[model samples]
Target: MNYVLALFLPPLSILLIGRPILSIVVFLIWVPAIIFSGGLTHPMFILLAWILIYQAHQDRRAR
Candidate 1:
């Protein structure tokens, strides 16, 4: 299903790519995906994605 795929793909891709910018982009992409998929009730998951993105950016800046 598109909803399931959308939910998983962005995070997985970010993990695979290992890039902060890409992960941030992926997290941004999830906004619309969640909206259209009617998954906004799972806001915590979105927050987790944001946390990952933030950590990635922090790591990049530290390097």
Candidate 2:
């Protein structure tokens, strides 16, 4: 679920994990990075969002 979202919208995926501030920050960085790098740096943010989503899910399971 989140993993697929992360591929297309990393910041939004991060938002789903409950980090509003971080999501805003990621979105700010992501938009420019996408434009400036011509999407080359996108994978980095995607991996980050995916990791955050995974971690959040793991935390929920632990609770």
Q: Indicate which candidate wins on lDDT.
A: 2
Write one digit per residue (lDDT tens) for candidate 1, span 1-63: 986786776566566546667666666777776878787635655566667778878888999
User: Quick one: best TM-score, which candidate?
Assistant: 2
Q: Candidate 1: where is the Cα deviation over 4 Å? A: 9-41
Q: Where is model 2 poorest over a 10-residue stretch in terms of lDDT?
A: 2-11
Which digits, one per residue and each the tens of the lDDT, describe model 2 over residues 1-63? 853453348888888889999999988888777767777987799889889989998999999
lDDT per model, in order? 0.67, 0.81
RMSD of each: 8.1, 4.7
Worst 10 residues of 1 by lDDT: 40-49
